[model samples]
Target chain A: MKFKNNTVTLDATDLKILEALQKDARQTYTAIGKSLGMAHSTVYDRIKRMERQGIIKKYTTVIDAEKAGAKIITAIMTVFTDPKESENVAKKLCLAPQILEVYTSLSEELLIIAKVIAENQEGLHEFIACSVAPLPGVLRIRTSMITKKFKETQFSIADNSKVNIYKRNP
Target chain B: MNEKMASRILRTLSREKAFYFFTSIGNYTGESAASLRTFVDKIREMNLKSLEFHFYRGDFEKWIAEVLEDKELAEQIGTFRNSSPIGESLKNELYRILVRRYSKLKSMLY
Candidate 1:
């Protein structure tokens, strides 16, 4: 099977390798080769090719926030500003350490959902008031504390299934 | 989808200067705990600058019984719930034991 993304075409073996690494990046090339019934060198070569193609950006470690002693807060912020100012405001929000995830909503309103972490409620408030709220074009910021996390996982190749490959006529 | 959610949570945690732990064990059951347990165990190994535990008033024991469905585990956690709203020591001890248990179980399977 050939998985094509724009101009890049990845074979079945490549997809399998990506899936394996997505599960555990620390898995040795030998271990991955054994599982996939390929040689260690083959696994190495495939990974190298994928990296060069920019499919695999970087390896990262995942940490648990609650166990580490920080409070998790999720906020849905709606920025009431000029259409031209939206991009600037989003860029500014990205620079703050406390602002975790920020993405624009599909609706007309410039809505952004951000995940923030702080030592406590007071620290969270301070971050929003002093740092985030003051950014140009940021009109209002509403935050809600994340009381519990039911499920969480790192990025995996499985998500690629949702991508639409068919092109539509303009 | 699950991995994305976990990644977002991890990214949020990584940027913090202080360490904090939060888990809603009651929302998960057997297999779902795998990723959560792995993440918790990994962070525990890191030498963080500061460590704290955050929780709702009585969520600790509630999670054990309702989510894990383990009466014994809930009883063990209940002993720690006797204190205040945010019991740092209790949370730390409970997490340590849980992480150890999960790690041991995982090793046995492999």
Candidate 2:
């Protein structure tokens, strides 16, 4: 664990710890220490340090929606909005429970991209026709349904290797 | 238990028939045990979430009974599940049950 002002560089041990937590977030420090053959207090300190540095982000429980009886269809909706009202429309989209993610594109296009979920095809149709189409943006909408998700995982130790976080001053 | 039945119960299972621990649907802890020994080792190491999840779902007993072909151990786990012990207790007690029966079964092999 090597971190300075605004520079957080995790060593191999830290990455291994992160991997263990990613696999099972609820694992206690003692259990993690036993698994990795490290001290529990040391593990605790590392996790706390990562949390303070905003590297660890947050811990959350991942629910299986389909297994929980909520097998909703996911769609990536690209709503082209009036440049002035794009922010407004994006904020409004955040209010709906069906919207899983909402992001106002910062690129040239006045677009509000959102990851939306619906009960079924009919539900999605109703959502687009009733809720989205009537928005004040007053522009066309393009939706790309996500029929199959090949990979959907938060960037972890495995995915962060390509990042230059490990690179430091010469 | 009889010697023949004990042998069947104590016999090693294939990798395909191994039990996997899942805290929730699609949430795999990456902990799996192919045999009774490995199952005990996993039970000891498995996170509390997975322990509670499988205990409540009766998955432990189902695997033990069906895959391992240890009806007696399965019945023990089944009875234990019926008791509805909490997370830590479930792990400790379940481990005890499995270890006890496993030792007895091993002894019967000779």
Chain B TM-score of candidate 2 stands at 0.91
Output the number of the TM-score-best candidate. 1
lDDT, candidate 2, B1-110, per-residue tens: 69998877667766446666656532334456778888998998888987997788777887888878888788888887777898788889988998998899889888
TM-scores of all candidate predictions against the true structure: 0.53, 0.52
Per-residue alpha-carbon lDDT of model 2 for A27-138, expressed as tens digits? 9999999999999998999999889888889999888777898778998888778898888888888999889899877677778888988878667755664466556663
* Residue A51 lDDT, candidate 2, scale 0-100: 90
iRMS values in order, in angstroms?
Answer: 14.9, 18.1
Candidate 1's TM-score reads 0.53
- DockQ versus reference, model 2: 0.01
How far residue B11's Cα lies from its native spot in candidate 2, in Å, is 82
Model 2 steric clash pairs = none
lDDT by residue for model 1 (B19-85), tens? 2222221111111122335445544442221122223334434444544343454565566555442
The whole-model C-alpha lDDT of candidate 2 against the native structure comes to 0.78
Model 1 bad stretches (over 4 Å):
A1-7, A69-80, A159-170, B1-110
